[model samples]
Target: MILILVKLFQGLYVSNSGEPWVEEAELIRRAQAGDPAAFDLLVERITPYLYRVVRRLASDQNEAGAIVQEAWLRAWRARHRYVADRPLSPWLVRIAVNVARDLWRKKAPLDFADLGGEEIVLPDPVPGPEDQLTRKEALERLVRGVKKLRPEYRMVIALRYDAGLSYKDIASALEIPLNTVRTHLRRAKSVLRLWMEAEDG
Candidate 1:
């Protein structure tokens, strides 16, 4: 599986100007019929986006990568149940999120201090060293704030922001009502804002 993942990552980095999901339905059909090559192709194209979502929930890259791999393995095993006509991302994201939640149940609380290295864009494009430092500090504080949120709120925030899923998609992935998704996001943002403000003062 590690060797297969290494090959998948190699394909992920290659420049493919074509549409990522142009023939995704056909690929899904083939995969559902037990085509490993077709399934590998789909994994190659989708892993980067999946990794971003998993990375937000995981304590570190190693945990995130493990979750991603396990998600794909589970997806492959359940391929027969997936409808080719439906959008694939939500289904896959649901699996990844479930895997993360399961892991969390067995481990310590999530640590966001490692998240400070993630990029944060400021309004000033040519910021000085001081500005850069300030941005990093602010991002660290925001991550710390995220750490304090309830598990459901953190899941909604990661799905909505890191994965860039629509509210409806988040609802589907989380098996929750659309209104609940909206409520969680609103409350989570409010809590994070207050936490950041308190930290700044």
Candidate 2:
């Protein structure tokens, strides 16, 4: 929200072409004035991370998608209420998590096996003779490592690494305090590091 990263670039006058280019102020102004494109850009910029958070929180794929879609619609409908000066991702994710939580609450109770499931079982598919072995091996290892993690740790790692969010940003987006973010990262890294070491051994 404070644009601290941009402050350093201001001195060098270097611009980021790859970073989110939508001007926050301009987007807010347009959205407030009922411009649809501005609202669309806001959704586009935030959807990936918001989806990831919802997927982590939701009980299944359908619920995750539903929550994300509901959150976006609600956000768009309530766009005028959003403070232009605030960070959008946190605001958006807050809406998403709340939606997911509400959905979760409405569901019937589940068995422990359904909630805290064990490692996923996948069929050993037969590959063609010409299949790329190296890529397959690498992917298998990545999946194994991820599957070994606790769901909570896995969600933190996915949100931070796969979603490319900073520690502070993740903390805000997930609605957790800064120390909890650091704790989750620490635990996730430690788990991954141990898994890698064991694989090497």
Candidate 3:
């Protein structure tokens, strides 16, 4: 903890800086011990990661930010319960995923905008009109497929693929068995594939 505090003076060893930094589990341990700065540092470390996770699973920039905040707040409240041996990223992700899922359940509707905001960065300045159209159609079909799933199935799809969360993370987030998470993801992909294929046909 002393070394971590010292490093904070130098930017917490930004990941790309090629400097060794405090691991998330240690941060969480300190946070659980009621260290405010430790908790703040932990939040600082994972804010972008949380934002990316929520952005992929849910929609709206402001909404995603809010979800991440909510997740952090919830995590803070439950920090004492965290298992220190397990890495903190998955736990944080699980909380955010649950928060997003709960919000989605309340909304009870998926829209075009909900599936919007995915950034497509291409090096080429221009893609041909046909290629552009192909990409557009593919995205539309993918969104449509997403809209067709049940809420639970949709959550897994969004968390596992869209958000790039592990099956274990999904399980912890959903408070279900690991195998259940796998099943949900497997069934979700199968359903979406069939739906997309049917749409194509």
lDDT of each: 0.79, 0.63, 0.69
The local lDDT score (0 to 100) that residue 158 gets in candidate 1 is 91
By TM-score: ranked, best first: 1, 3, 2
TM-score of 2: 0.54
Q: Count the backbone clashes (under 3 Å) in each candidate.
A: 0, 0, 0
In terms of lDDT, model 3 sits at 0.69
**Which candidate has the top score in lDDT?**
1
Mark the regions of model 3 whose C-alpha exceeds 4 Å error after superposition.
1-21, 109-144, 162-165, 198-201
TM, every model: 0.78, 0.54, 0.64
Write the residue-wise lDDT of candidate 2 on 67-134 in tens digits: 77888778878888888788777677767756765665676543212122123233354666435564
- Identify the candidate with maximal TM-score: 1
Give Cα distance to truth, residue 78, candidate 2, Å.
Answer: 3.9
Which parts of model 1 have CA positions greater than 4 angstroms off?
6-22, 108-133
Candidate 3, 20-81: lDDT as tens digits: 57777777778999997778778767676666666656555667767877887898899889
The C-alpha local distance difference test score for the whole of candidate 1 amounts to 0.79
